[model samples]
Structure formats: C-alpha cells, structure tokens
Target: METSVFTRSIESLLDEDEYRALQTHLVENPESGSIIPGSGGIRKIRWGLKGRGKRGGARVVYFWAVRRDRILMLYA
Candidate 1:
C-alpha cells in the first residue's frame, strides 16, 4: 500500500505528547484510514486523540483526517 505524506497544518497541530503516540501509531500501523462522506472534502480521518495528564485539565484529544488528494494528518 502507498502511504500519503502529511500536510503542514496537520504537523503544526501536534503538541509534544500528541506527536509521540501519533508517530508510533503511524509507524506501527499506518494503513488504518477512516473515510468521511460528503464532508466538503475535509476527510474525518481517525488518526486518534490523546488525553490530558494527571495534573488535571480538560482532556479532549481528537483525531481528524483533514484533506484528501493531499495527505493531511488530522487532530485536535
């Protein structure tokens, strides 16, 4: 299978912690791709999200598939 390269927006979205898990997920299993129909072209790819640390904060991590044709690693 051919792998798509990631976009800059998607790259910028990643924080230090987020990138760690995300990178591993991609390296180990990058074939997983979720498609979103009729999304104005912005694919809702389920890359996976993370949670806040034990320090206590609104842990709301999100995975997103930003664009298509061009590789876009989506996240929140």
Candidate 2:
C-alpha cells in the first residue's frame, strides 16, 4: 500500500454521491473482505476493502497504487 497514492485517489476525494455509495456498501455487506480495482488512471493498482464494523464486518475501502514510486498518484 502506497501512502501517497492511497491519500490521493478519487475514492480519497469522495464526492457526495461516492460518499453515499461507500456508506451503502458498508451497510449492505457487513461481512466481506475484498479488493476492487480503482479507477482514474490507476491501473496496475487495487484498493483494499475491509469490513471493520463487527469485529471485521462492514467494510471500508483504501485506495492504493501499484507503482514503485508515489509520484503517479492523482486525487480526484
């Protein structure tokens, strides 16, 4: 996980709709651990989604980049 990349992603810069979507995800699937691909020029990268609501239920996503360096991060 790249700190800079995770800190600077579209998911990191959640808009009104995106924030609601995340909250919905947390509510719906309260016990799932998964990783989904991130968007916006962040190929070769995947964001980790971990549920921490019920002793690791109800997930949150952390966007990450796969580059060797942190210069490629682009926050939306």
Candidate 3:
C-alpha cells in the first residue's frame, strides 16, 4: 500500500487493469514472491504482461511490511 514516486511512475507502465490485479494479488498474498539476495527482504515476482508469458513479462520488486500489513512496491 506504500510506494515511492519512482515506484508510482514505474507502475504507470502497466495497464490500469494489470496494476489493479497486481495490487489485489499482493494484498492477498504478501509472501508470494521469493526473497531477493543482498537486498534485505525485498522480493520479486514475475508478472505476466498482456499477451506475454512469464519469460517476457515484467519483474515486480517489492517489500512486504508484515506488521503494518502493507506492501511497498519498489519497481516494475
């Protein structure tokens, strides 16, 4: 639920519906992504773009703040 200006700008690259879907999925499964090495607890997920498979989709980097039940979307 928290994002920086850069993150917001990066998210704008996604279609509106795709962005919403990503948000909903993250809210429901904050731990869905695997922890990224050398980056604290930041995680990354492979999000499929429209008409593209995982191999060609975007990588969404985020941090889950469990205590606050919030996800800090960092990049996409």
Candidate 4:
C-alpha cells in the first residue's frame, strides 16, 4: 500500500530504475540505515541520484517493524 504523500511526492523524486534499486537494497538490508535519535525505531539512509554521489543524494526515512516483518517507508 502506498500513501498519497509517497505516491505524489517521493515517487516523483526518483526515476524508475533508482526506485527499484532502493527497494531492492531495503529488502536485502533492512537495518543498514542509521537509527535516528528520539524517533522511536526510525532509521535514515542515503540514496544517490543517477549523476550524483551519496552526499548529494536524498535521505530516506524508514522503520523496521520486526513483529510484522515489514519496513515502513516514512519519508524521503
């Protein structure tokens, strides 16, 4: 399921290939992102754009829902 914010905002930030790569990375390494303080269990990871490095990339915020075995993508 996709939220309106994700579909409208986040989806437009990346191309199809970049989005797929992000999804694949998340699926393989759910906890790879650094944990954000005071945000419960939320974590943040960087994603580079096609012509940019990770430093010039976007920040993807997500949460690992262990009980449900799901990763909730909160923001980007």
Maximum-TM-score candidate: 4
lDDT of 3 at 32: 94
TM-score for candidate 1, residues paired by index: 0.35
How many clashing pairs does model 3 include? 0
lDDT of 1 by residue, 8-43 (tens): 344555566776765565545444444445554333
- Specify the poorest-scoring 10-residue window by lDDT in model 3: 1-10
Q: How well is each residue in 1-76 modelled by candidate 2, as lDDT tens digits? A: 3245544555544555754665455345432324444544332222233432344322234333335322222322
Quote the RMSD, in angstroms, for model 2. Answer: 11.6
The superposed Cα distance between candidate 4 and the true structure at residue 72, in angstroms, equals 0.9
Per-model TM-score, in order, reads: 0.35, 0.29, 0.84, 0.88
Top of the candidates by lDDT: 4
- Top-down lDDT ranking: 4, 3, 1, 2
- Please provide the root mean square deviation of candidate 1 (C-alpha atoms, Å): 8.0
Residues 27-69 of candidate 3: C-alpha lDDT, one tens digit per residue: 9998999999998899999988888887888888899988877
lDDT of 4 at 68: 87
TM-score of 3: 0.84
